[model samples]
Target: MRKMHVWDENNLIDISEVDRNKVINPMLVFSIKRDGTKKCRLVARGDQQDLSTYSKDRQQDTINNMALMTVLAVALDHNLIIKQLDISSAYLYADLKEEIYIRAPPHIKQKDKVLRLNKSLYGLKQSGANWQKTIKDYLKGKCELEEMRFWPCVFTKGKFLEIIVCLFVDDIVIAGNNVNTINQFITDLQNRFDTRIVNDGSPNERDAVRYDILGIDVEYKKGVSMKFGMLESLTKKLPLLGVEFKKESRYNIVPGTPNRSLNQDLDIPCDKDYNAKVNWIQRAIGLSNYVAMKYRFDIAYYTNILAQHQLYPSDAVLFETERLLQYLWTTRGKRLVWKRNEKETSELIGLTDASHAKGLKYKSQAGYFCIWNGKKLFARSTRTSYVCESSTQSETYAASECLAISRSINYLLSTLTGKKPDQILLTDNTALINSIKGTKTINLDPDIMI
Candidate 1:
């Protein structure tokens, strides 16, 4: 805080001068990194402040997972150098909009005085928005980068330099064909804000770029493929969740069995230990959902099922959760590999499927995956909002949802690249395909058509 001059120490005043409600208590948070490094941050109890005082546009946008993956595929196709960076004290660089007061920290030796903030601080409701605006202005104005219309967190430099920069809060991933241009951009960023490269080794010594972002480990192969996985993270978390491996001859080939009915209603145990069990089940489901979303699409369906029962999970649900974790542990080496596909033409390819009336409430389960350059860009497994009367109707509903998401992905691709690529959606249901081809008539809800 002293280095950034986050606040003026001389401006401290008595509490009577400021509204007591506006004054927030300061908090210090500390954590240990994987490398055994300790870090601390001073934050404010922003929750105590009046909600009406916050700006309606305080929520900041980050690059979506689909767009991030698409960019990585493009980078792999072009053999672009991928590097990562972290902005030191990122939120502290932004100027605070609202008038806020904080009680002095214990080490400051001024217990009676309240300090006025000049810049954004951690834990503030609008801190993210303020930091986003700060970085966006610097990139657009100082760095001369153009922000993508569809993805505000993505920026590119055209004409002379072919570079792309993606922002996920404080972390930055830069991809470009020109090494000198990328280095120069990094230099400019460092000059503007205190920053450090997140790449594992020194640039000269680094053979292949490797780093972790958003809990996903990313590695760039020279001309092969970009590999993404969560093995290391999952390995560390499994023991904490009580997932154990025993000497067994056989292991689960799949995350869950298709024949097993995960949606069956089971009585929740009324024992005193039920709450603790429920919490453990929820935690396991949460971790599984993260892994499924980022790296493993195979577990997506089962993880979604476990998530639905998180509120009141039965012993059977807990057992299912453990099985999913065991499957993950058994196949921890599996990763999503984005290989360079020479014949890949389209920017986005979609495949969708539906399970008719699979849930206890008679709701259909819909799942869809979007692909780029023959690699999976993103996938989603969700239950439909309304129950469908037939399998065809459920399939049609799933297709509609997939089409909506594909349009957004298409728009993002078009904005990034000058030309929009053709989209092809595959479905197994013949009736739905025939309806689209005008060969057969199938009654679909007007809302679904829209």
Candidate 2:
């Protein structure tokens, strides 16, 4: 905060301090890394933002997951070192454009004086957008890094060897072919912002510590691979759903069964306890969906099914939620392994499928999973809102959704790889494929179009 001039106590405004400027108590959250390392950090309780109105566009700053995956794939292909860097008090690094005030922290001796913020502070809605703009300006204007066209959060610089930097809010992951280039980038970051180079231990060392970023614990093996997992996090998270796995419990080999009754369109009678367990069921599905989205794609389809019934959950959904927890417990040890394959190709493959009118409301369920050079890039499944007249239309709708996601992924890969690789989309419906190629005609009903 001192480095950024976040506040000036002496600066006073004529207006009286309002309740909107009130601050909440900060707390510390602790977690264990996948490598059995302990981590802890203090975070402000920023939930008081409803007190003020935010009209600014706040979604355009960060890079998407597909962009991050592209950089990771590029790094893996080039045998480059990937290092994570953190900006200290990232929000405070930018000056606030609006004249805002925040209550002084409890530890300060001056209790009555309100802090007139000179820079952005935590709990302010605009802080993230402001800090992101600040970082972008510094990198592009001062450091001379060129931002990618589609992925604004990704920057590239070249001295002797090209260095690629991917940003996720305040956390940065950098990879380059030359060690000196990587070091110089870090030095530049440190010169501009108070930065900490995390997980700096020698990759070849067995005792080297891994780092945690966005709920995934990442470990790099110098020349071989990068392994990531949410094992330690899931260990602590699943118990909150009232799920406790015993050694005697039978483990399922797959995430969900082929004839998974959870996804079947069955109108199970809502028992008296359904309303009571509604919150618990929603919480479980939310936690499971997070795990699925970030770390495990295997459970994506299963979790999506659970999320559809969140508003009106039944006994069966609750039962399936428990089953999902058991599945998580069984596969907690599984990690997303990105290994160095000499023959690895920059291949973009998309697999999409849909269950026609399988939903209780007769809506088709659609899902797609994508991969880049054997690494899972993105996956999503959803029950379509529109009711389809035929199976081909359902498949077409599913394929279109998959195509949208794949386009973004392809754009990222094209920018990073400098060559747009062929995006091969696989689907089980031959008529849908033929319809896409204009070789077959399929009628689109008015309801389907809607």
Candidate 3:
């Protein structure tokens, strides 16, 4: 805090002078790094701020998962050099737009005084927006990089867009075909902000092929393939789920079992112990969903099902959640691999399906998988919003949803790679196919019409 001059300690004012409502509490967040280094950050309780005092649109945008996956695929396809960097105390660099006072930390001797913030602090509502604008201006104005229209957090440079920089708040991934060019940009970025290149303990940081970005372990094999996994994250979460393994314990072959009946016992009295168990189940489902969304597509359906019962999970649901965690522990090493297809075609392939009336309340389950040049770009398994009368209607609804998502991804790939890929939406329903080909007319809701 002293180094950054986050607040004016010398200018501390009496607490009675400022509005008591503006005074916020200070928070200290502590964490350990992978390299065994401990770090602490001082933040403000932004939630306590008066809603009328600040704007509601303070949330900042970052690179979405689909865009991140597409960038990875592009890096692998072009054999680009990928490097990661992080800006230390990123939010502290941005100046505060509004006057906000925070109570002094415990270490300070001034118990009756408050510190006026000179800059943005962590946990502030506008801190993320401020930091985002700061970096966006630096990248666009200073670095002369053009921000991609589809993804604002992504920037490109060069005549043919040789360099691509993806920003996830403080963490940055720079990919380019030229090593010296990327390094030069890194140097420029470091000079402007306090930056550190993410080093994976490699002999040369510039030539690092393994990286941990956004909690996903990414390993690149030049032009061969790229693999993404969450082994360390999942391993850490397993113990939190109260899962233990015996030496001779057998593992589950699948994350969940189909056609399993759930205990619909909502009449059970809600006690403290029951509420605790419900919270535990919710946390477990949250972790499982995170893993499934990031790289574990196989468990998406299971996690989706488990999430529905979070409000009032029974012993059966709890058991299934634990079983899923055990399955994850057994297959922790599994990774989502993206291999370079031998073919030089730029195509976006989509596969979508739905099971009618499979979920509770007779709701259908819809899923879709999108592929780009043999890489699994995106996948989603979600329960349908409304119940459908027939399997054909459910399948059609799923295909429509899939088409919308696939087209958006197709746009991202085309803009990044400079090639318009043909999109093929595949479905097992012949009636839907015939409807698309004008051979048959299948009645669909106006909103689901293709």
Candidate 4:
């Protein structure tokens, strides 16, 4: 889905379980890696699979590719991500040799006059290719050529340095160790794709990166703090939970090394960044959300469920996310400052409660809340309790059954929070608690009762 983004991210991604939206259709996500690899993935519903495909036309792809690559390189050079840029309305930054015509999306009359594209945008084919040719040509004169691998793009220079850019038509990823090389690439890209630069609006360097150094409104999240250590962005190579998610693969071994197969050459494009990932707005007080925990916590909820599937997520499930950005914006200057005897002890305590009636799953809903030192978490479960059976039997059986998840949550919470609290587990039926409490007693059921 190579389309233009229409809504503000703060407007959508941050929204909780329930919210409404005016625009809800397929959106083209144009994410070009800093190196230059582009990816086009659909963001439509499960049923909309019928309407997905890369733009077949050549002209559109050409312009978008160039504009995107040009802008992408600029972003990398300037060290910007999830920032904003406004395009001049109806601007087509393409230099086209052939005239093209189009039928606007259904309902509108086909224009007698063909829309001439001077720039690339949502719809077009060769646009990306043309733009890439334009940028590549401009870069040819400026950047010193080093080394590269195709299919899943990879480029290298000195001993251990490389510039890897993946191109999904125009959504690119550019990664390189040489600051000069990356910067020159950006300059050349802009020379071809006219993008309005907005780095000037960034904040002064005094802001906090992680909230803790100072104080964050949301204590759970800390303000990002900046440190001047050298940085490397090694793309994570997780087991392809769903799709191959081709992006990166093993590097660092000699070409003739025998363990070649041990490290699967990533089917995904290979690219990495050598630049320091400073605070949100380039250099600042904070850092990229804890280098690791970001992805871990993000995948926590889905880990078990997704691991179960093991295979690829239906094409509908390629990971496309901006939540981290939303999270960034929301907690831009926040950090979880851990202080000893800060008057807050990290202790864990818990309580669990269950109901008598659940739904068709024939399960009861059991919920638990954990309080640790200073933090708290609430979680619940239903599905793991009962499989379906006779309604009368299920109702009474479910009523007398208590899900055992509370104990597991209590233990995990204790491990994290450190503050252990007495757990008061509760269930609606007294008989249920007795059964668990008195597991030693055998009360064989002659018949089920409501």
Top lDDT prediction, candidate number: 3
Q: Which is the winner by lDDT between candidate 3 and candidate 4?
A: 3
Per-residue accuracy of model 3 over 292-358 as CA lDDT, tens digit each: 8887899998898888777766778878888888888888889999887667787787889999987
TM-score per candidate: 0.91, 0.84, 0.93, 0.28
Worst 10 residues of 3 by lDDT: 441-450
Q: Tell me which of candidates 1 and 2 scores higher on lDDT.
A: 1
Q: The CA-based lDDT of model 4 is what? A: 0.31
What candidate 2 gets wrong by more than 4 Å, as runs, is: 11-56, 109-112, 159-161, 206-211, 256-276, 438-450
lDDT of 2 by residue, 193-214 (tens): 8899775645545833376766
Clashing pairs in 1: none
Per-residue CA lDDT of model 4 for 335-366, tens digit only, reads 22322223333333433444433322234333
| Number of backbone-clashing residue pairs for each candidate, in the order shown | 0, 0, 0, 86
lDDT over C-alpha atoms for residue 141 of model 4: 44
RMSD of each: 3.3, 5.0, 3.1, 23.7
Off by over 4 Å in 3: 200-208, 246-251, 263-269, 439-450
lDDT, each prediction: 0.80, 0.71, 0.81, 0.31
Residue 63 local lDDT, model 2: 70
Q: In model 3, what is the error at residue 432, expressed in angstroms?
A: 0.7
Query: What does candidate 2 score on TM?
Result: 0.84
Task: Tell me how candidate 2 scores on lDDT.
Answer: 0.71
